[model samples]
Target: MFRVLHRAGQSHDLTYVVVVIGVVVVHVVLVLVLVIVVVVVAVIGGVEVVLVLVIVVVVVVVVVVVVVVAAEAASAPVPIVLTTVTFLFGERTWR
Candidate 1:
């Protein structure tokens, strides 16, 4: 009976050691993963900001060009006559 108790005690101590080691290893791995995620997000965040700015600039340029062209078309005499005719007849009359 004494020998059986001793063997049980030894096994319990071994299990405790294994649990402690596993906990430490898991904590270290979690910390490393967190650090990697933060680094990747920081680098990608800068690139995303630049890409968004470029898209905004391109959209602004396109809007400005469209507005300028529409203004010119409205101001021209031929388009004005064509618009009036289309309005009255439901279709454009081209001479």
Candidate 2:
């Protein structure tokens, strides 16, 4: 996670990139949902599409918020260590 942040920070435009990408993704999802809802409404003329669109919009917003939060937190350094241990066992008879 920190690796990604480090790379982004190196570019000296991490904040701008995150904002731009977030906006683009949100817009794309919003437009796609609107188009789908319109098509469904036209074909079925049912009110259920409104509920679906609302749910999709909420989900999109939540997803974007989560991504932004995660990315922002990733800017901090994280310590990770790996170690290998060998265990020796005496030979024994099975009961």
Candidate 1 deviant stretches above 4 angstroms: 1-12, 46-95
lDDT of each: 0.50, 0.51
Predict model 2's lDDT versus the native: 0.51
Q: Residue 68 in candidate 1 has what lDDT?
A: 51
Tell me which residue pairs clash in candidate 1. none
lDDT of 2 by residue, 2-83 (tens): 3334555788866544544454565587678767766777578566766776677678777875675566556633211100
Candidate 2 segments whose C-alpha is farther than 4 A from its true place: 1-11, 46-95
lDDT (tens digit, per residue) of candidate 1 on 9-95: 687755434333443454467567555655676577876765665566557656864675477457653343333334345442544
Clashes of each: 0, 0
